[model samples]
Target: MAKRRFGRVRQLSSGRWQARYAGPDNVDRPAPQTFDRKKDAETWLVQKEAEILAGDWLDPDAGKIVFLEYARSWIEERPNLRPRTVELYDYLFRLHLKPTFGARALADIKDAHVRRWRKDLLDNGVSAVTTAKAYRLLKAIFNTAVDDLLVRRNPCRIKGAGQEKSPERPVLTVAQVYALADAIEPRFRALVLLGTFGSLRWGELTGLRRRDVDLDAGTVRVERQLIRITGQGLVFTEPKSAAGKRTVVFPELIAQDLRAHIKDFAQDGDDGLIFVGPDDGPLWNSNFNRRFWGKALTDAGLAKIHFHDLRHTGNTLAANAGASIRELMDRMGHSSTRAAMIYQHGSHERQREVADRLDSLARGQLKSGSGTQRARKPKKAE
Candidate 1:
């Protein structure tokens, strides 16, 4: 076989040519693949020589590190991630990413591998929302790998694979919200009302303290949130974003109930938890869902719903009440306007607008009606 200045090629027993060269680090490296012809092998060596001379060569052996090790280190190296976010990353790695890619080398992961893994997850009935989160995580890990030069390019190139097409969450009407609040145990009535009208997240509402709430002023300060992370149990942490730290001025309609809750259920100290379970401890979601939420759904004749839907309902109410995008973002504690836009630009509400206009066009032919209606049951709470 012929020799080259950059690399050498030798014919294999099967008549294929293998290329070997000294990399810029002076380490002898082999071409990743054997070539069908000596010329092909020499061509690869030439390209590697050019890359080395141009300072664009990446050490192939670096990518031999297993994906699991790199991914774990990636999560660990990140600074200032919320504990719940770290927990979620761990969860996704364990359940979704680890099973398929953990043992594989970073260099071995390909776009096809990601596509097949995503397809298998969907086929196995894993939720799209969950799959999307996992996919995004995988993509992010690979992104860092590219930046670190572990791999030449990101393997996660599927378009729209990272976007979650979450179903529209159910929102409770004012009457329904009030009925559900009343149907729950008396101690949690104010908790439920605050969740709806104030758009308080589960973590924020459960983490409230006597010092954080001013019943007379009808404002609740959101300085912190309580999150339950696996292994660590309940942890009190700052809000997810800076916008989450803002205070909310709630409707005066619920002031009476707030005072009653404070008097009947709250502790005297400033640091006292605003909401608690029967054990008079930190309010746990599992206990509340099993003991209160399930029963409240039955008594109020409402269908199954997640607790976060209360915040969803509150956001919708605020949007219907003409809250601006910034106002909604502040109330919902969102870092961006994308989530707020979902509530403001709902297709169902737009369809109603079209129907109402069409109804007006036909008003001459039909009898006049009550026009529009709004629920007024929240004020009726005893």
Candidate 2:
């Protein structure tokens, strides 16, 4: 490392005098800096030397590239993402990210600027979770720029970066489930029943075909989901993930109800949609939720919950009935066990029953009166 001393200028063989500062990376790299006079070199070198020693020396050239230009390039390069996902990314960029650092060059973005942005988001009443998501998007964008050599480092690496806790969803009780079922119109009753018992999502429920239900086998095949896109509107697509394509079994009673439902309401063709509008076309999510679900829940005299809560209620009931974590995951089509565990919090009665069974097995009470304990019966028979 070059010793820190002002006015110590070196004249190269080319007769150009330049000031040099050793980088913290433990190498004597040139600063690409030039000076017209020895005094100028000394002043520049002294200020740089102090900053380097303070462990805060950053090259200013990095902060020169504007963030908006890089963000546009980033969005354009990703063509394979789903339309809904792309729309969300674009929304986050325009509403949150771009407005903050749109004009700032990539090289000029600093840790302090990122910190202030996070604070401003909180001050503006944006939820911590949304802010965190936006932060991650920004981090990903800048990290790509770093790989491309557009910037020295990502400024998003500072601590307290992302959102923390996700909001909790309320689970419904068995009585509330029945009330919700009874309150809806008879035409949409099966929809509520399938959602509550089978744990089908809104898209999955609306995407069902007559052939997907096997009444004798008591199973429903989940093959596709309805997705609402911004520009193209509603379309049926394959399940979001492989795990989402699954078979769910229901009780024989529910299966019987489904059979009757088809015989009376559903069309004869196998390709006919199981749940459709009065004109036999695809069901619109907004119209169904507004006309059927909202009024049903209100009449049931229960808390206002979204249609998606029916799926949660199903998972909760299964968990309370002693369903294993893996079984619940498979039924819910959850790609991971983490979310399924949240719905597995059952009542104290179930927990106590499990504890008592475990205690009996551990204490050898199960073998106390077995056939091996027979006494004198063989002698009497002889």
Best-fitting candidate, measured by lDDT? 1
Per-model root-mean-square deviation over C-alphas: 8.7, 8.6
Model 2 over residues 29-83: C-alpha lDDT tens digits?
Answer: 4546776666776777787778788866665554566889889889879867766
lDDT of 1 by residue, 251-329 (tens): 9999999999988898669999989888789999998998899999999999999989998998988887778899999
Give the CA lDDT, 0 to 100, for residue 380 in model 2. Answer: 62
| lDDT measured at residue 266 in model 1 versus the true structure, 0 to 100 | 82
* Model 2 residue pairs with clashes: 62-107, 63-107, 63-108, 64-107, 64-108, 65-105, 65-106, 66-105, 132-163
Model 1 TM: 0.89
Task: List residue ranges in candidate 2 displaced over 4 A.
Answer: 1-64, 158-164, 359-382
Clashing pairs in 1: none
Using all chains and alpha carbons, the TM-scores for the candidates as numbered come to: 0.89, 0.77
